[model samples]
Target: MSKTILVVDDSSSFRQVVSMALKGAGYDVVEAGDGKDALGKLDGRKINLIVSDVNMPVMDGISFVTAAKQLAAYKFTPVIMLTTESGDDMKAKGKAAGVKAWVVKPFQPPILLDAVAKLILP
Candidate 1:
């Protein structure tokens, strides 16, 4: 079966671009506007990975990763932070929150895809 990846970002355009790339690579994509929305989309569904943006309104990516790690269903699911913030502090926070990989914005689809391939659970 194809893996399912949740793409969480406030920008509709960003979500669209990520979705297109994941779908093209033969993976299923689920989209959410922010951390809260991403949590709502979980609903017992099988998600192999999550790609998120750090800065958002409702809930930020680090906070989302922290919350997601607490959930029994998703504790083991890997997260990739895709955002503009590349600060050491922010990366450290994400690492503490259980994020598996970090990808900066203006990213090439292929590069993100490679990370997804490496992190997505079987």
Candidate 2:
């Protein structure tokens, strides 16, 4: 079965782009406007991976990751932070939150797909 990836970003266009890439790569895509919305969408669903934006209105990616890790259903689900931030402090926070990978914005689809393939739960 194809893996399901939850993509969380405030920008609708970014979500569209990521969703298109994941779908093209034979992965199912679930989109959310922000971290809160992403958490809402994760009700017992088996999400193989998560790709999130760090700077958002509702809940930032790091905060979301911390919250997600506390949940039994998502404790082990890998997260990829897709954002414009590339600072060491932010990356460290993401790592502490259990994020598995980091992808900067304006990214190439092929590269993002490669990261997904490498990190998505089997």
Q: Which of the numbered candidates is closest to the native, going by highest lDDT? A: 1
Assess each prediction's global lDDT (C-alpha) against the native.
Answer: 0.94, 0.93
lDDT of 2 by residue, 3-113 (tens): 999999999998999999999999999999988998899899999999999999979989899999999999999999999999999999999999989999889999899
lDDT, model 1, position 98: 96
Over 1-122, each residue of candidate 1 has an lDDT whose tens digit, in order, gives 99999999999999999999999999999999999999998888999999999999989989988998888999999999999999999999999999889999999999999999998877
- After TM-score superposition, the amount by which residue 119's alpha carbon in candidate 1 deviates from its true location, in angstroms, is 0.8
For model 1, the stretches where C-alpha displacement exceeds 4 angstroms are none
> Measured by TM-score, how close is model 1 to the native structure?
0.98
Worst 10 residues of 1 by lDDT: 61-70
Considering summed lDDT, which 10 consecutive residues are worst modelled in model 2? 113-122
